[model samples]
Target: MKTFKVVVTDWEFENLQYEEAVLQDKRIELVKAQCRTEEEMIKVCRDADALINQYAPISKKVIDALENCKVITRYGVGVNTIDLEAAAYKGICVANVPDYCMDEVADHALALLLSWTRKVTLANAYIKEDKWDFKVTRPIYRLRGRTLGLVGFGKIPQSLAEKVKPLGLEVIAYDPYCPKETADEFGVLLVSLEALCEQADIISVHTPLTEGTKGMISKAQFDVMKEEALIINTSRGPVIDEEALIEALQNKKIAGAALDVVEEEPIRSDHPFLEMENVILTPHAAWYSEEAEKEMRSKAAMGVADVLLHQQYPKYLVNKEVKETTRLNESLDQERYALLTK
Candidate 1:
């Protein structure tokens, strides 16, 4: 009858009502904190049996300091904040809500793409400045028969392809790992990254933040892009080298860019993108909607509750390679638990 403690390491949610309600029936003490640094994480999470995280550094130092932690569940799809390898080595489970906000992000990305393609935002700005001349916004091209290059063909891009299909855009993708058959289902043709860059009228990035993908869209990629090509990045910012993008935009190497995420959060006042009319910027808010937030919070808390309470198998295990060694599976004695790793 030991009561386990689940701590929220960091969050931007206005309240913890959904998480608290989800864990109410379990014998868990839910604690919330706004930990920014590893020292703060180590101090607040030392005794936690499970943790729910968002944007907090769960580093090797913080992991080694834990006395009895078992699981770390993330609020969103990305687990870049948590040290997955360190947690796995410590026999802890790392799970995430991988499917939430797919639709919302796809919609936002499409909106950004359209804003650039149709000059919607720019035209609106032009009208507001007391300029009523329609001829001011010129050179608008038709979307039909134009190639839309998707940098990743994952869930969000799949949704994006489906939504953008009837818009007369020819969708192509550049995911070295995406199955060609998967792309074919959405009428998207998988191409080499270079080919996508060379052919696309619009390039929308949807890749994750991995070491291999940190600067996947750097100078080399930008060099091959068409002069009229526009890029949209709703994914992680560092994926496109900021310096290279600025250079490209300044030199007119590419037409423009629409970005939801920047390489650095809360871009500084003097950032070059601010002075560029060809660029559109929105705070990293692609994965927002009231429904998505509630789903993410509750599902994240439920993941913690499931592992701590020994409920069904964790539905969204991130570090699945460590499933066999996870403390939660090792401690279970039920014959049914023998199939846990499967």
Candidate 2:
């Protein structure tokens, strides 16, 4: 029996103990490589049957070289780093683990919201500096009876709404894809984007980063928000313009912002947002939990197995077109194709 070759980028391979169980299945061979540069990624993915990438840029140049690759699986939910159009053009199936850390992210967003509203970080800094009168510099607010606006009412936002409902928050959500009935099910009022901005006491983003969503919140949007409202972003960083957010915070246009992600990963040390008292920043850890990591790794490995064994389709396919192309190709057996199509 010929073994199928699977190449995983170094980042995903790191701390992935579940690969051992996968390697035990003799039909598949897992090869790990750390591709720091585009050239290295192209070279490593050249002959791979399936590639599992994490934070590696699969540009057009790299995808063009993968003639043997039938599928590309991301270890996490976000695919902003990968070029989806290029992958689609090459007929490569792109899969991601979209449901793994939904609750973790919602919890993290709530944590940030509470921390910012209560000035937890600021209070800690004040004590370290021997300033007992921190209350004079930074005041705290109660979470009860506040209007919480969710920019996108996806799974994370839905979970967040449920969690905060007990705290007496009036949740309003804006998501064109979600139905008004669904929002009503969660006791959340569905509102327009502009209305959400103007009426919300706290606004949190939970949408994906796509052409329509990129820079959706900019200077003009911020200008309409209430000066007392706080902003929280656990979603894609670029969805909200970082420059506009910084200016808003600097000029006291809004109360504060708690960001788990920024326009740039590993934000520069000299970034102006880092120096502001009204801004709270975290290093993209909103989706991180030990249990979530285990689930993500297990689900990602299963997705790879499903593709290679020509079994069922992945639960979360980034490119739906690839499934159609794969079905037409006759490379997968009739039974497998039938199962997928059905």
Candidate 3:
């Protein structure tokens, strides 16, 4: 029997107890590191058979330094931090925990939207200052009868639509990847991105950050939205141009924006978003809940353990192109190899 070493490149959670419990095995050993940079990651990952990463960059240089790494698993849905092309070229499988925080993110998006709509933060501040006038936070509108435009109708946005249904919001979504039948099933109107921008009373962005979607919601899109429309983004930060969003807010092109993620995380202290009273910021914590966090950790560790112990493919393989060619899968029996390839 072969023993394997799995290194967690980085994790910000309070503990790795859930991961340790799931990955505990006589044949497997786990090492935890707080690698924040590529140099740190390359140094510690040299001897790892597998890596579970969170908020650490696994670049080409880091991948090249891995002596015998068979897999790299991300703790969240997006693999933007990892160099997928590099891992695929090196025949290393990549996996992610895609569904772990579906409900939490949707709930958070709605929470931010409500906070913005009801002026809860403004009210809290006014009261703290001993102001009792309702006019201090003026022009609050009823949520019902407002059109909710969803930029991406993936699982999280779909769940958001469901949650907002009881509030009487009309849901319209723009997702080239989602089929019309799927939109019909969700009872959401599928529309062109242009139409959604011009028509929606509130825009919630749930798209991932990709080459095509990096600046999808910039000045032109914002220009078309209603003057008082609220924008909520719980997705990647760069999806909406931060500079453009700041300018829009400064000019009052839109009512306000509630952001749980930013284009540049750990936003610099001097960033203009900090001074905007109309803007609500969360520490990129939309995908958080005690239950969700534990599930994400356990599932991410189990993805590595599945490939190593049970000879099963991961449930959410990111680099499917490397399945048949990976060193780990190739080392299995013909039957196991066939299963892994599938």
Candidate 4:
């Protein structure tokens, strides 16, 4: 038997070749399972020295049952699915591949924004339906000189800002932690969340789901936005309130929205967004591309190898506090494990 055991709790890829290749040490045995629940996670993960997680719930219960897990490396950047507090209590270092999909997600957000502003999809639908007229998408406004407000001025949004500025869009951001120098360099004005909502012609969300960020953009923000304003989200779904968004669209509170994520994964068939002609929806696919998939897999697997093999920290730690002795929620008091690692 191998001296150290690593398990892939779950994955979306067709095969684990990248993981296997990364964890090729003779003493490390890599296992794979489709664990869809806490019970399943506890069953196979108890014996694992490390885990390569993808969407599996590594909740408090599962963490309690983990006998030997030293690390849990996620395939994507978000660690909301895992209980960071619970894992920290058990000395498990939770890691994520934070930088792998920056380009893909930024590009996707830009695509959604451009598609909405240009009315590309609406025009295509009109022509394909044999209507053959521009009046259907009338009142489309010029993109130049319009303001684009980014909710979080993180790496992805920064990339997006760079891409949009060349097209004559002004970028303003609302990130309390963003350095003034960075904003000045990018020619972006850092404003309050409320101010951004009221001032932007187009609002794009790039925040992670946390206590503070969940439902951050709701009725109040919607109430303040211009009637022709559009919002786009490529970040976590719950960051924007689903019910409020539906109502906003129904009431024409905002001109439109383009979402790559929703409050619920695989939104129900009877979802109201489906009926709204102004909304553009995509299946939480902002972080995808053939190259991105492989890079994410390789980096995540290597994170596990770093812990179980090299006895080092994963380069991108979601919960870095695990490295120091626990102080009973002192660090988590305000942040509350929500801020995705920068």
Candidate 5:
């Protein structure tokens, strides 16, 4: 039997048994590491046949140092942490678990939206302070007859729209990539980014971070929003300009902001958002659930296993150009030929 070694880089999860079980029958040996730097990763993953990475920077330097590494599978959807161009240049297949956390993130965005809209946390804080007056937190709006604008119409936003439909919300979205027909099918109005900014009562951002989308929501967009409008972001933090968000919040250009992610992680103690009563912040944990976590870990490892043992490409391949040209595919071809001759 042909054997392969799989290395997992920098996972914070408490368990690896799920990943182990998925690759148990594939004659694969699993090794785990808490690599936080390129040097550390290069040292431990030099001889690896494949890698499953979570939040570790897999740079070109790390990819170039791989002696025989074939695939690098990310534990989540966004591959910004992994150097896709470097991996592709080195003929290493890059894969990710794309659909694993759609529900979790959507649910998280909804929870944040509700928390801000209903002033749940604010009420709790007031009660803790021995203030028992509903008048302190005024202007709690009813959910019905509100316009919910989604910045991106990807899976998570789509799921969120579906989940919140029962709340009697009028959902509209601005996604240049999504067809108007698709929005119509879901009973969502397709609008321009400017229109979404100006018209939405609640704006929820779900776009991925890319050059074109980074800082897409800045001072200009905030200027157009309603004075009492609420904004929620479960997507990457950099998609919204943190500085502009701060300015808008301070100026009351918007009613409140809720975020599961920020432009910078583990926000500093001095961060302004921490002091704002109208703002709600959570650790970047929008894409989390016990089931989703397990699926992400297992599916990432399975992608490596599929490449190494089954000679098949991962369904969620990030670098599609590497399918035939990758060194991993070449190695698989060689293995298939050897087995056939035997």
Candidate 6:
């Protein structure tokens, strides 16, 4: 059995028992390291044959430094921190666990939406302050009969729409990529982005970060939303302009917001959003249920195993072109060896 060195970064060594169990059967030795700086990452990853990274930046410099890296398995769905183009150029296959957390994130989005609409957090605060008079407190609206605007009608949005529909809420979705028939099948109104903003009683974002979607929701988008509309974002933080969101929240341009992500993670203590009672903030944990975490880790490990075994491309490859190139290279190498031997 050929032993390979796999480096696991940004993981607590004691907590990754599942990863250890997977590695035990693969003849893969695991080197656990926590990187705090770019320099540390480059240094630690220099001799690794494969990397299992979570929240660590695999920059071009680090990729170039890795002399023997065959695969990079991102521990979660998002690979924004890694330089994917560079990894592809270096002939390193990148893989991510995309499906494990979809349900968790959708559930979190619904939880946030309900919390904001029902004033659960605010009511808790009021009770703590000894303001128990129900008549004097502000009224909370029931979610039934409200319009929910979904920014992207992807798998997570589709799942959420199904859950929301039975609750008597109308679902509207805006996705340039989705066809009208697809939306109709889910009982969702296929509306324009502008229409969603103007008409929805609650808006939730579930789009991936791309050039067109980066900072997609800015001042103009926020200005068009109903003043009573509650915005919820459990997707990437940069999708919404943080400055614009803060301004809108401060001025009461929208009713309230529940954010499971922020532009700057572990948001600074002095951040203005933290001071607002109308805003409910969670530390980017929408995708982090215990079951989801375990599944994600195991699936990511499977991706690494598939690549190391030189098997057919894994189902969760983000870059299909990379796998094609790898297969082509292997075929050419076989042809050359056969020619020399014959």
Q: How does each model score on lDDT? A: 0.87, 0.82, 0.88, 0.87, 0.87, 0.83
RMSD of 6: 6.5
Cα lDDT of model 3 by residue, 119-176, tens digit: 9998898899999888978889998998999999999999999999999999999999
Tens-place lDDT digits, model 4, residues 1-342: 447889998887789888887788898988889999999998898988999888889899999999988889999899888999988878888889888899999999999998998899999988898998888887799999999999999899999999997789988999998999999988999999999999999999999888889999999999999999999999999999988988888998999999999888888899988888899999999999988888888788777766766666777767877978422222211131122211
| TM-score-better candidate, 5 vs 6 | 5
- Per-residue lDDT of candidate 1, residues 47-141 (tens digit): 99999999989999999999998889998888899888999888788888877799999999999988887888888998999988867667788
* Model 3 steric clash pairs: none
Q: Candidate 1 — which pairs collide? A: none
Clashes of 1: 0
lDDT at 103, model 1: 97
Candidate 6 residues 86-123, lDDT tens each? 88888788888878888899999999987877788888
Worst 10 residues of 4 by lDDT: 333-342
Q: What is the lDDT of candidate 3?
A: 0.88
Runs in model 4 deviating more than 4 A are 325-342
Give per-candidate clash totals.
Answer: 0, 0, 0, 0, 0, 0
TM-score of each: 0.94, 0.92, 0.94, 0.93, 0.92, 0.92
Candidate 1 is scored at a TM of: 0.94
